[model samples]
Target: MGFESVSDFLAMGGHGLYVWLSYAIALVVVVLNLIAPLRTKKQIHKEQARRLRREQSQI
Candidate 1:
C-alpha cells in the first residue's frame, strides 16, 4: 500500500497506536533480554572478587 504522505504512513490506517505500542513492547523485551545476562555476570564477578579479598585477608 502506498501512502500519500508521511502523516498517512504514520497513521497506519488508524491502527498506528496498536502497531506502535506492540513494537515498543517487543523492543523493550529484546533490550531486557540482552541486559539481564550481562548484569548477572557482573554481579557474579563482583561476588567472586569479594570472596577472593576475604580469603587473602585471612592468609
Candidate 2:
C-alpha cells in the first residue's frame, strides 16, 4: 500500500472525496470540542464577574 506520487495518495483509489470529507469533519469536530469548553468557561467567568459587581454595588 504505497503511493508513487502525491496525486496517487490524494486520489486514494477513487475514494478521495469520501476520505477527505471524513477527515475534514473529524478535524472540525476536534477543533470545536476544544473551543466549546473554553468559550463556555469564558462566558461563565464573565457572568460571575458581573454578578460580583452587582452584589458589591448593592452594599
Model 2 C-alpha lDDT per residue in residues 1-59, reported as the tens digit of each score: 99989999999999999999999999999999999999999999999999999999999
Q: Which candidate has the top score in TM-score? A: 2
Q: Where does candidate 2 have its weakest 10-residue lDDT segment?
A: 8-17
List candidate 2 segments past 4 Å from native: none
- Cα RMSD, each candidate: 0.8, 0.5
RMSD of 2: 0.5
Tell me the TM-score of each prediction against the true structure: 0.92, 0.97
Looking at model 1, residue 44 earns an lDDT score of 100
